[model samples]
Structure formats: structure tokens, C-alpha cells
Target: MSSQPAIIVSSLDMDRIEALIEKMPRLTPEVEQLENELDRATIVAPEAIPANVVTMNSTVRFKFIGDDKVFEKTLVYPHDLKHDEQVSIFAPVGSALLGLAVGQSLNWPMPNSQSRTVEILEVLYQPERAGEYLR
Candidate 1:
């Protein structure tokens, strides 16, 4: 995988993610990846986030590079995940998707010591864009 592209995360989301990380029982590779992302993130006020950027609770459309199949999923915290369509922030793909803007791509690490390129095609809904900063 190449160097990661720039990412922007909302301050509120960053705070919540940090708290969640603090409660984890152990540091998994996924957790470490998330921490790396958090460390490099450009944080902005919730209202200042671009509408096309994926934020916590945002529903996004994305696809693996070179794949014709596109998928839509909602990025959610662990406790709020209730179905297959929702991805926890602790998940590798979910962590990779956080803060990515529409048209941006990242090389997502897999458990098998491989990586896949994932591109953000669209952000269908973002809580910050909807004025739901407290969510």
C-alpha cells in the first residue's frame, strides 16, 4: 500500500472515537490502524465538515478499486451496530472509510496480510451535514 491520502475528521467524532478506543480490552491491529488514522486526521468542527466527507453515522457508497460492484453501508460505533448494513468503527474496512471524502481512495489492510484499494464513490448521508452534531 502507498502512503495514505489526506483525511478530515470532525472534532466530535474524534472525541467519541478516542473514548471508545480507551475502553477497549486490548490493542488489536485494527485498533492500532484506527489510532494511526486519528493521529493523522485533520479535525474540524462538525458544522465545518464537507458534506461529501464520510463522518460517523454517515451512509456511504463505495467500491473496491477495479471492481464493478458497489456497496453501501452506514458507519456506526460498536454499540449502535444492529445489522449487516452497519459497520463498526473498530472494523478494518470501517476504520479505513472514516473521514474519506467522495472520490478519495485508501488501501485497506486485510487480516491475511494483504490490502485492497477502496474508493469512496459517494456519501449518501452525513450526520454533521444534517446538523445532527450530537448524534
Candidate 2:
């Protein structure tokens, strides 16, 4: 029973993520969490997703609750993670960022058995927003 907020996902991103999950040799807890998120997500067409929503390859600015630090990341597939600014979707924080819209928040479960509240400050570069949906 997490207090995680509802999420929306693009159809194309969902399809790609599902295919990646099927290829995984083992399903870890983080991966399982991602599966759960996907299961509960409201799926929408890429063209239909709002420009403010986070999609694959979106550059997002967010911050943890109770922390004044703001972090930026570009959500990407595993293969595309070659830089510090890019976060792989397989990672826990990355999974938590998916589908969140500006001003929305998520409860990310930490490895220390605690949770951190992450709030989306803005979506600087959404694929759909820039007309780069094929990514």
C-alpha cells in the first residue's frame, strides 16, 4: 500500500518497456516495481500525451521533498545511458520518474527500507513536446 500517485504512460514507451522486461533473465524488486507501475498506468497515445508529461528521453527537473537540491536527468533506455545526465529506466529512481507530470510527486522506496518523496518541478525536454516521438 504505497501512497504513490497515479501515472500516465505513452503507448510507444509502454510497448518498448514491456519488450525489455520480457528479455530480462531475472526480475528484481526494482523491475517488479516497474511492472506494477506499468500495470497501473493510464496508457495513452504518444501524440495524446500532454507536453508537460515525462516520456522516454524527456529531460526532467525534480527535487526530493524536504531537500532544497534540485536534480536534472534525461530518462533513457538502458542502451542509451552513456552519460551522467542520463538515467536508465531500469534504475529505481528512473522508474519512479516515468509518466510523472510537472508538479506531480512520487514516493520512491529506498534500499534502506525508507521512502523518499520526489516532486517533478518541470519537464524541460519531453519527446512528444519536441516532436521527437520516434525515440
Candidate 3:
């Protein structure tokens, strides 16, 4: 089965989303349901998770659609991401990638019918000393 376990938005990322949902009452049922789903889901507090997190200067193994090779590149967190490698929280790929563990695979859908498969091989280091995404 696909490892993509429903996109659970972190509370830190949902601060703005919550406010926007409140202001925009015209949202459709599905959108409103999503907000409720997020509200119901307990956000895992930022703690030291046992898994490794991607950080600045951390080495990682990742794959993309076009490239046959499993690229080994040093990750630059919070910044320095290329179009394919660097993903921001607000970006589609970025939202899908954050907080992934090694050996975990996820299939993410693109705007088109295309899909991207991602797997984590190694997490060289964690930029955050504390938090669920760090360990």
C-alpha cells in the first residue's frame, strides 16, 4: 500500500490555515470537513522523535520521476532547495515531504496525472534539537 498516510498538517503550519477557514465561511463541505478533520486530529507535539530529520548540511538519498539515479546530495534546510530537491512547507512537494522517516516511501500526486515516488535512505542530521521532526 502507499505509505502516504493522509496529509496531517502540523499545528505550526495550520495557525494561518485555521484563521483563514474562520474568515472564509463560504468554503465547500469537503474543505470544511478537512478543517474539522485537522481540528480533530491531535497534533504530535514537537519532541525528539527517534527518526532522523533533514537539516542543513545533512546528506540524503532521494529519487525523482525523470532521474534514474538515486541522487546523493547534501541537504540545505530552511533554504537552498532546487526546483526538484528543495521543497517548502507551503509548496505541494514540500508539504508532502516534511517529517518523513528513512525507509518510508510515499506516492504523491502532481497537478497532472503524474505521480512522484519518494523514499528516505539516510538522514545525516537534524537541524532542530527538539521537536517531533527531530531526534
Best by lDDT: 1
Model 2: per-residue Cα lDDT over 7-121, one tens digit each: 8999999999999999999998899999998999999999999988888999999999999999999999999999999999988889999999899999887677788888999
Q: Per-residue alpha-carbon lDDT of model 3 for 1-135, expressed as tens digits?
A: 233443333344356446655676487543444454455444543443334643333456766645677766554323455655544333334433445566655565554556677666676554443332421
Residue pairs in steric clash, candidate 3? 46-131, 47-131, 47-132
Q: Least lDDT summed over 10 consecutive residues: which range in candidate 1?
A: 1-10
Tell me which of candidates 2 and 3 scores higher on TM-score.
2
Ranking by TM-score: 1, 2, 3
lDDT of 1 by residue, 44-132 (tens): 99989999999999999999998899989999999999999999999888999999999999987878898888899999999988889
TM-scores of the candidates are: 0.96, 0.95, 0.50
Model 2 / residue 5 / CA error / Å: 2.0
Query: What's the true lDDT of residue 44 in model 2?
Result: 97
Where model 2 places Cα greater than 4 Å from the true spot, the runs are: 1-3
User: What's the CA error at residue 72 for candidate 3, in Å?
Assistant: 6.0
